[model samples]
Target: MARFNGTMVALHSPRMNGRGKLMFSRAVLLCLFLVLSSLPVADADAEQQSSEKALREHYDLQEGKRLYGEYCRFCHGEQGKGHAFNVTPPPADLTSPAVQRKSDIELAQTIHEGERGTAMGSWKWALSKEEKQYVLLYIRWLAQSR
Candidate 1:
């Protein structure tokens, strides 16, 4: 007899039948089969969810590029390869994987909140929360294109 959670699994094969517990053994096998057979549905659901998330993210990235052109191109250039700046670190060469490796949250924070004491001025006053997210998606798109 094996117990899992609060249920006991009693198995009785022919060898165990000599012990007069063959019925219990059969019951346990049936229970195990029922439990195992029901698990694949959850796995299918998880795969479906993963696919949906990828599709949504892809669409958001497309929207992000539009937002970036409107709000960021003046300083970052049309390609985001950096343009204006006297000696300031040129706006990021956003196409680089090194720059894109940052998570979406990190990118959004940097764009919306800005890195202080540097020429990277905050856009919090200029863009809304959703706009910042779109910018992040645009940066991601640029990096992937490279």
Candidate 2:
């Protein structure tokens, strides 16, 4: 936003009479108020963004836990390790160094497309990107809490 340059405005104006001076002071006050009022808007926007990010993360953690229970527990087990059910292979231990070493993108991709020739099935048809991330974050939190 363009700032009000009072000096430039004043220079362009004719010499002020007592009444004009009063009007000029009022205009300057208005300009200052406008500038100052706008300053807090920037702060408010940043604060709002921070709050939204935190809220989303909180929701992801909660939803991820829920989703893990509903979809993953049958195989991955409650602790993200192998479950008792017999499949050709078992679910990956999410906390294992090998799995944890995968990049976030790689993890996301695996979640999206599942492991080929394994019990893991592609969730791409069922989960959104954000949903996948939530599960990923929950998986991370699992490792972290462990």
Candidate 3:
């Protein structure tokens, strides 16, 4: 029997054993399995969110903006839409999906080693590794803001 909202309801199972106990243990086990299986997925999502938050805290967006202004703005423009200069093939639009889809390491490498056949020169000699990361963070912010 089960009580719900001040009402008692009889719980019956036609497939009960001789002891008068419901033979629905498999159903209970299945429900338990489903619930337990979902726990790891929830934990993974929470972990991902926390890691992203940590990354955000680790980087300074203000410094990134400053670096962008000093080094990247001449080509990428104030909004990072690119094509600010009249160069052939033009600079990559930092806010575009194609650029945004690139991994941080790839973008960082590009910043460290300038692309061939383009006006984008290497910043390896100019900015430190940390500064390059800051610039990457600013690029991500640009994509989001757009």
* Candidate number of the best TM-score: 2
TM-score-better candidate, 2 vs 3: 2
Q: What is the total number of backbone clashes in candidate 1?
A: 2
TM-score, cand. 1 vs. native = 0.54
lDDT of 1 by residue, 54-124 (tens): 99887888778788877777777777777654437667777777677877788788887777766677898
Considering summed lDDT, which 10 consecutive residues are worst modelled in model 2? 5-14
Candidate 3: which stretches are off by over 4 Å? Answer: 1-59
- Candidates' C-alpha lDDT: 0.77, 0.85, 0.91
lDDT of 3 by residue, 8-86 (tens): 9666666667565534666677899999999999999999999998877555898899999999999999999986888
Q: Which wins on lDDT, candidate 1 or candidate 2?
A: 2
TM-score of candidate 3 versus the correct structure, residues matched by position = 0.61
The full ranking of all candidates by TM-score, starting with the best, is 2, 3, 1
Candidate 1, position 131, lDDT: 72
Model 3, residue 140: what's the lDDT?
97
Model 1 residue 68 CA deviation in Å: 0.4
Which model is ahead, 2 or 3, in terms of lDDT?
A: 3
